[model samples]
Target: MATGLLTSEQAEQIVTTCRTAIGDSLRSVTYFTRDDYEQVYLRNDLERDADLSTFIGHEWRGFKTAQTAYEGSELGDYNYTIRVFDNGFLIRVTNESEGVFATTDGLTVKDFEEVATALNSFLGDREVR
Candidate 1:
């Protein structure tokens, strides 16, 4: 698969995986590379015109940093991040070259693992642990 941007089929797979894990609470899906980003899906109830450029940039940097933060630590490989908010959650699954971050209304502890694991699987084994 290409690293620059997600193909429509890939984006659809992401949406389906996310919805399957998070159910109706899935809020938004954003795919980002080192240089650019795209919002593949946004729930109908959310704001359509919100400024996300700054947020996307932050997420990209944060994800990249997380990938290397614990090199050789006993905690093992980096997997994902879940940031809680008053209204929702931001779950980021990343590799060195590209990433997919999904926002959802809320999730059970198990839902978090399921979504992260599913997305990480979607990113695949070639991306490094």
Candidate 2:
């Protein structure tokens, strides 16, 4: 039962797909549309009361600007963003309708590439539905 745009099964699939790419290093998965968001999964080691509004706002505003920011540039096109922190990484994947952000422990460059590819494929397919 989804409290938002994504179904429970779809949420599970997102987690499964990401975990397959990044393993237990993946910490949490949150789904967000333009107006709302939901934490579909969180690791047991983590706290429940995170303030996700900041990330949600970034995804809404930043991604929109990002898509247009690179238009006609040699950089080609906009893909995802990986924000690195001291102890973790924040991976953001978005399409026009919605997006998902995943927090993770340490990961290799290949792991980042694979997870980005996996998430983009998943979210891209969802936009058609």
**Top candidate by TM-score:** 2
> Candidate 1, which segments miss by more than 4 Å at Cα?
1-4, 125-129
The TM-score, computed over Cα atoms with residue i paired to residue i, of candidate 1 is 0.87
Show the lowest summed lDDT stretch of 10 residues, model 1.
Answer: 1-10
Report lDDT per candidate.
0.82, 0.85
TM-score of each prediction? 0.87, 0.91
Candidate number with greatest lDDT: 2
Instruction: Return the lDDT, model 2, position 87.
Output: 79
Clashing pairs in 1: none
What would the per-residue lDDT of candidate 1 be over residues 5-102, giving only the tens digit for each residue? 76678889889989999999999988777677778889988887756677778888897677778878999988889999999999998877778888
* Alpha-carbon RMSD, candidate 2: 1.9
Q: How accurate is candidate 1 locally (lDDT)?
A: 0.82
